[model samples]
Target: MVEALNKFQLIGQEQTRRYWETLIGSGRFGHAHILSGHSGVGKDALAFFIAAALNCKADTKKPCGNCISCRQFLNLENQALQLIFALPRRSANQTDPFTGIKEKEMILINEELAKKAAWPYYHLQIDAANDIRIAGIRKLRKDIYLAIDPGTTRVIIILRAHKMNMEAANALLKILEEPPAGTIFLLTTEYADRLPDTIRSRCALHHVPDLNWKLIREDLLQKKGVDPVQAEICARMSMGDLAAAHGYAEQDNTFWLDRIRATLNTLAKEDFVSVHKQVLLLADKEEQTDDSRQQFLSLLILFFRDVALKVKMGETVLWATQSQQMNKLFPNCDSQGAIKAIERTKNALERKVHLQLALTALFFELRKHLRR
Candidate 1:
């Protein structure tokens, strides 16, 4: 087995670590644990680590990496550790042949399907919680009744547990209330408020706060080979989200910089046609998925927000990277107009308007603001 130290990275969660140790040491390890936090806070990583530690057969306080149990666990041969993920439902465009399988029957990660699932811009639909489906729940009931495997504990890690619908949630509640012996359920969610009170009550809650900027910067510098200045900048912009920081680090910022520059330049010149064209191009690129469209709209909002901040603060702009461009463009633009445009865009997103129409209308409004 690979070393436990090598498999997991636990940083800045000393209290949570103690809590887990106490639970395990006292032998009162609850059947259900809910790990809640903001997105990109490493909650999922923590959940998986806890699951591994519980199933490990190390003689020490923690899992020893060289044991037979650890070897099987690392190889994913420990059938006791199961993962139930929220999968997108089969739409007209995409379908999974094995959609009806029970949670207990699922053993292998379908790599091909996983790649398709990871396609950017796909939103989590309400119907993706197959593990919580009536059929799935019945199967889980049966599985729980079976005797525990010797030297192994059954564990189920459910990602985005809040996505489960009312029926699914109630089913899960039943399992939580009277979970079978030697079974552990680890639930992770970015939005815990969506979960029902009854369901939340059954689980031990652990809050995972966002990673500190210092840690984020260090990780970027040491692991990603990012220069100090760039790492610091991305870390600040990410607002404690390591995932977002990593994404920013990987992205080619130059394209976005040029896009924003072009937008400002055209608006300043009152070139309505060019403005419309650019917005349409952006909307077209985002047409593949609702999530992508939302993301693109969010980026535009941030760009305009930075512009507004630059105009208001003059030399005290927080986003220094865009300050020079702001200075060059602000004199010719209307601050109130920009603010109104932002409001309209946000309103459209909140209303769940179609992506193409919303963006087209947004740019049209922006053009009016530009001329004013």
Candidate 2:
């Protein structure tokens, strides 16, 4: 039997891996753990690995990758895995957690989950999902107490746990305080501080630090078959987010940068006609997926950051070619206001606001900020 479990390409965090392996091997790990970290740092991946280890059927070693249980976990077909995350709001009188979810929304959620299962580092997204509602937690409370096989551990993972509203958070707190036997809770969030203090106090916090830039670049080049030049650019632009770096590797960075340049000029000139056209293009389902939309927004933010760098340090990093035009347009760019507006738009998008409306508002906000 293999003594060491396969990491499944879970990249770095040697210390975190060693700690969990030892604890899980000893069969004395805590009932609850919160994997807190910035985006794309493998918090969810680590949590999934730990959950797999806990439920692995190998007698002498945990997560013996060859076992039936491990195979199921890798395929995300493991019966023991329970995933919870933010979802769109249900009807006011709807008590069933999933009954109110529209068919398309459900399909999107499942697709994102499958992607995450295939690549542990992949970030999951559902366009309409915003917050974890109480009904889901209520259902979980019932499900946790159900009977399971002997020696099996039920793993419940709540991704983006900080999105839990007050009602759902309180409901989850009750479960953590007196968790059911043979069950484990793994909560992950980029914004752990946003979680209630009481909930934070109950779980063991494990901070997953950002991945190294060189390591990300290497992974893209070796495993992802990304071009060396593009890989380096994505790695640097990702800001230590490996998942974002992977996504960037697949995207046409130049195209997005060009779009941003054109959009910025329109916003600066207060051209509502062109601004509306840009919004329609951005919101086009035929042209942009939810992931692409998010990528576009991120690129826009980076573009503004480049402007700030150019204004403050006399040099722009990401798109030096565009720096000349941007300088000519806004000699004194108000990057602070522009960034704040982008953030507000990002928040609005997460809340399932209409894409056209959100992008339109963002353009107006940008016009206000960039006019100076």
Q: Which candidate is the best by TM-score?
A: 2
**lDDT of candidate 2 over 15-94, digit per residue (tens):** 88888889887767788889999998888888878877887777756677667777878877787888888777756533
lDDT of 1 by residue, 39-88 (tens): 66677666656766787777765655456665555544457766555553
TM-score of each: 0.62, 0.68
Question: Which residue pairs come into collision in candidate 2?
Answer: none
**Cα-based lDDT at residue 73, candidate 2:** 80
**Model 1, total clashes:** 0
Q: Model 1 misses residue 304 by how many Å? A: 7.0
Off by over 4 Å in 1: 1-6, 9-28, 64-66, 86-109, 112-131, 149-153, 163-168, 211-253, 262-297, 300-321, 324-372
